[model samples]
Target: MTQRPVSNPAPANNPAPAYNPALSGNPQSATGRAYPNGNPDLGYNPPGVRNTDSAVPLRRDKPVIHNYACKDAAPGNLAFRWTYGSNVAAKNRDPRVQVVQYNEDSFVLRQNVCVHWEAPFTYLLFGNKGALLIDSGATADAQHYPLRATVDAIITRWAQARGRRAVPLTIALTSGEDVAQNQGLVQFAGRPETTIVPKPLHVMKRFYGLANWPSGTGAIDLGDRVIEVIPTPGTHQDGVSFYDPYCDFLFTGDLLFPGKINIGNDRDFVASLERLKAFAADRPVKWLLGGHIEMMFVPGKYYPRFATYKPYERVLEMLPAVIDEAIQYARDVQGKDMMLIRPDFALFNGVSPDQRTQVWPVGVPNINAPRPF
Candidate 1:
């Protein structure tokens, strides 16, 4: 008998068409094209980065998927009222980070079309004394990502808003050291005020106060705000997840994204989920924001693999309840067999040590690039 994919009985949040594996993640389809349906103007075509109208007025049949993530309704002031406007700006005008003011002191810096196609997201959160930046883009080259400049601009703006000069900014990685998010190290080499959390396990162990290497927990302070850092190493050897207290949001990097979730260590990944479940018991989590969203129009419909343009993207947030599903499905599948593809996330099969450093399509710069910082 052939093994089958396991999913929840309660129908997917996105409209059906049901599940079709062929178009979701079979290499070519993994990075497939998901053009913008409403208007062609916002297509993410390199020189002129593509974007969707903040008020996309999505097709009636295709209701807002986020509204369905939870039934009880979202928490107070935790909504993403933002609209993602068109991306018709000139090529030279595009910056590596598409900065969106999310909250009073919270800003989201999404990677641009000109940078890595993965188009990973990094966040800048500000408090009284300083701020925290999560994840560098796919490259450290200032010409490419220019993450440091963007941060500097934001700091200046923030200082001006508060009638004060800029404070120190800390650059941190999720679940730690996944190469796709660490190319910006060189850009901040000489900055005296910026404190980038080192990626090595030893350094992380000390920084996070994790006497335990793979599973340690610590707190990160951004002035008046404090975020929890939990070591979740299955996604990568040094993977870690950060929690924001003010908004009751959890910023999990690739660990909880909508796209391909490749697990490097099975034990660590499952344990991380359990850790999250326990952590949530105390904190009132409003929204669980993740690193990437590869799915498009329909349910389980993902964009092509390695493609820089994600024209038909889903909402960037997921309900905290999905964590329970992820944890349960991860446990259910493991009890039956080796690796199983769960509904929300995948329980990736463990890989060899040599294979850990290698990513598909071979030799991709973001995957293979050497990090000197």
Candidate 2:
């Protein structure tokens, strides 16, 4: 018993062990502790201590949650002044690509009329892992259009804002045959960390996961953001439309816009419009964005072809009611070869190639004089 009571003391040259609240189970003093409020490394505070730093909260007081499963769509802004290019390319100083930030994760880009007469609109959407570019504009030369450069800058800025290193891009087109929309595809070639969907019917079907060519829908998963790809091949055989649930935007491309609807297949055009109407019946569609806006503010009036200047251009965002109206108009002129001009859109069903050169006013026949039969 007397031997057990005797204990050896630490050497005089030895230093004292460091104090750790986690290991030692001791309360840290305010002055000697590295963190004045509490141990920063600890997940929870000691019995009597309060966590002063908000970074590690005691409990979730007001937690914010986003229920993506809900069918309701998120609202966004559409109030923007689009850059309508000048009549003369030499005098036009507008940016080749006009980008409008609809929301935090979505951008609406438009090519200047000076760059291409069509001045098509493109959509860029971001998700957790990557981004999706809906359509390429009408310009191929990046030196003149700067599409790739503009997209690169946007992706870079988005990644930096989200503390990410890289964001992969996927380029898709509404219609592979549309020269006004796919001319800029060449700019994205050979780009690093990019995937361009081949402009072919079979390839697009596989790329978008559409088992049925012109009936069944497909999907493009941009991580958390899933875009519904509907088979809309009325204006063109390879044409497809995209529906974004987040923004509730139905991107109809050239199928339906505030411009001329040149119907490639009359039956398919009507069927596609009916499908769109049914699809939008239950779902809340905020807007039906299209490839281009050729209509003017005046009812059934559009800017002259190849006219770069459009001062009185109509609003680009079309309502879902336009789908019903379009379906009716398309069915009325199902087999006709004349242009049916409406207040919002002009239906060019079976119109001849030469008819495109002539401007048709808002009327049933859409012709000013009798044709030389």
Residues 137-236 of candidate 2: C-alpha lDDT, one tens digit per residue? 9988989889889989998877765556778999989999999899999999899999998898898899877787777788777777888988888899
Give the candidate number with the greatest lDDT: 2
Q: Give lDDT per model, in order.
A: 0.63, 0.78
Off by over 4 Å in 1: 1-95, 214-216, 332-347, 350-373
TM-score, one value per model: 0.68, 0.77
Model 1: residue 196 alpha-carbon error in angstroms: 1.2
RMSD of 1: 18.7
